[model samples]
Target: MKGFIIYFLLSSITGNPLMAFLGVIIIYSLIDRFYLGFLPDFTRIFRRNRQMKNSLKELQVNPQNASATFSIGILYFEKKKYEEALKYLEHPKLKDNETANFYYYMGMTLMKLKRSDEGKDYIMKALEVNPRIGYGLPYIALIDHEMEKYAPDRHIINDLEEKIEKFANTENLYKLGRLYKKLGNKEKAKNLFSKAMVEYSYCPKGIRRIHRKWAILSRVYKIV
Candidate 1:
């Protein structure tokens, strides 16, 4: 009713339907920008960029600071600066850390850099360190699929399927759907996408915040 009233008033004042429609669109976009967050978080991006700059300064102060090096590399990775991320992540000091997270991030950075085989090796090492790395299975499946090594390591697929059954979250469903789609299991993929859509629709708004990216991807898959 409010939208109709606004449109009617705009149309009356402008004496042009298209202009009134455009005005309504602009108003809705503003509302979405401020309240709905359908757009990227510019504030978060700006803060991250600031952190990257600070990390660079910290690195200059202590060039051999493993923590600082890893921090800068992680920030670069999050910003999709894969090559720059590798420059820091590949620092010899990071190898001394030897944690699952270190290996996972290195693998992800390598994958983004198109070093798929090396990425796969690192991801496998990460899994070997801790099979329950929450984000590991999807990447493993993705890398294997990219390498066309279907079922090369059945354990990863089995592990992912098990996790999906255990968690049954929207994001997990969407990830599995993507894996199935990549492997040419269209019917299974379609079913998983449909399931993810239903889960997204019923999920609480606050919880949906975390699943937002997956929800968007699911919608795109449906369209395709």
Candidate 2:
């Protein structure tokens, strides 16, 4: 009702119903972008493409532009063009420098390519270089990998729990609970699920949209 009223007011002011509807859409999208975050970032897609093209042009001129190469490769990775991403990401020895981000992106791209072994190696290297990288997402990715193999070790689970305790967030806590549930540790799972909800409760309103799904899901899982 509120949105409809706003739309009606906009239409009346503009004297163009189509323009008013577009304005409403833009307003809603901006709200989601800044406060809700439930919607995907359409602007990022456009920015990635433009940056990729600019980087490609720079590489065409210099051919040894390490910065441009990495930029293009990461952009390709973001675009889900893994094969192409790998080509550029690995083309240079990164001037023989092994940065954490390069390791992580390579691992992720390899994982997407279905080369799990190589991907896991790269991801582990990334974690070894910086345990706190990607806000503990590297640990989450490994947990997911272990799940795929149906052989998640208790050590891995405990390590994730420790890291998650230090960097508690709804996404990581919920995933940790999921890991416990997968291993038949119902009590542990419930504890983690409850923690997830606690973390969500303290989350800032502007960023709550990022965690809302996991918060609601954790509530459902907590009771079960």
**Model 1 scores what on Cα lDDT?**
0.76
Compared with the true structure, what per-residue lDDT tens digits does model 1 show for residues 1-224? 88888899999999999999999988977765654557677788999989888888988898887888998888888888899889888989887877888888888888777777888787778878987665535353543445366536667656546655655677878877887787787887888888888888888876766666677787788667
lDDT of 2 by residue, 52-71 (tens): 88988998899989989988
Full-model lDDT for every candidate: 0.76, 0.83
TM-score of 2: 0.77
* Candidate 1 residue pairs that clash: none
On lDDT, the candidate that comes out on top is 2
